[model samples]
Target: MYRFLVPLACALSIAASATAAPRLVEPRLHIDKEHIGPARIALTFDACMGRVDMRILDVLLRERIPATIFVTARWLQHNRQAAATLLAHPDLFEIENHGAMHVPAVDYPTSIYGITAAGSPQAVAREVEGGAAAIVAAGAPQPRWFRGATARYTASSITEISRLGYKVAGYSINGDDGSLLGARAAEQRVAAARDGDVVIAHINQPSHAAGAGVAKGILALKKSGVHFVRLADTVAPHPTPVL
Candidate 1:
């Protein structure tokens, strides 16, 4: 009886640890030839789920700034209304896939991370294809780009995803708003922003403390004449083509 009880306890411990693991796992970003030559930067927003911020969308459209927004299935389900509003403004944003579930395991390697959302090429296709469908249903053009969950992915995953007809979107710089740093620190982070830098920030998490600072930094840079362009415009054009 005691031996059996010990085994059960061990199983419970493993389960608990697994549940506590993070959802994003390899954390790689890609910057190709065009970005290197032109000093062009791509500003990207991730809309995972929960808490929507229209202010970010408002600023982009009002300023005529174009960005790539990576959306998740959860976000599409929860913010269909807001999604419609964003799609209507094609001039300001291009919606792409963040992944179907935004699960951390989907982006990590097998041995390092115990979980993987799209462990196989087939699974990756579903997340990418399903996400595209969701955006189309919400009125946005199908996404030709795919940014893996948590920005973590393997070479094989990248190859498979690309083979399946999606270009993996990566970043050159990060705004670190997810850290929830205040506007001051946020300003400091973006102060280093330059041409050809792909900067990532979260627009879905409205309550993020750093959101205000991120906005300020962009505004300040714009005043200095930094032209903002969508990632698709600046990235290496995919063979399948996305207009």
Candidate 2:
């Protein structure tokens, strides 16, 4: 009886492992230089649940730089004025879906960087669809791109997202490390962006100094003659796999 139980337990362990979500390396996307031309970079800001970082938005407006702003349903719900501000400048800002609740797009029970994931393929779909619905309801066009919270995903989640007909938005440069960097650090990171780089920063943490730095960095990039483009203006295929 003991031997039989051991084997059964082993089989169950194997089965569980087989069905467990496989965490893949976080995807990094970039502008295809051949397709996007030279001296151009894509700036993408994540408006995860938080107040609008007007420092960054103000710079974009003043400089007329084009950006892709990925927003969650929660952010939009609490930031109607900011959303309207973004929509007010359709020529400069293209809002995309971040997620329904800023949850990582992982189709399993897990967490990325301490944030809980969406947990299942079905939940992932609801997240994607819910965020899209919220965006449309907020008066923005249907979001064609989806950038999951934490920018991490499992293989199954990526496949699910693709099956849903939205291109996943990834980034080549992390400008603020999720708004954790100091002003100088964020400024230097973003100011260093080059042609065909897709930079990710946060526009939801106004209290953080990183937003101010990001603002400065954008001005620096503009001063150096770097052209900014929205994600809609260029085709960014699935970024090169990190793993």
For lDDT, the strongest prediction is 2
**What lDDT is reached at residue 167 by model 1?**
77
Residues 1-243 of candidate 2: C-alpha lDDT, one tens digit per residue: 898999999999999999865856578898778853349999999999989999999999987899999999999999999999999999999999998899898888888899988899999999999999999999999999999999988777888999999888888899999999999999999999998899999999999999999999999999998888999998677765465
- Candidate 1 lDDT tens digits, 23-66: 33244353444433334556888887785766566777778888
- What residue pairs clash in candidate 1, if any at all? 23-104, 24-104, 27-152, 39-195, 39-196, 40-196, 105-116, 106-117
RMSD of 2: 2.9
**Worst 10 contiguous positions by lDDT, candidate 1:** 234-243
Model 1 error, position 93 (Å): 1.0
TM-score of each candidate structure, all chains considered together: 0.76, 0.91
Query: What Cα-based lDDT does every candidate model obtain?
Result: 0.70, 0.91
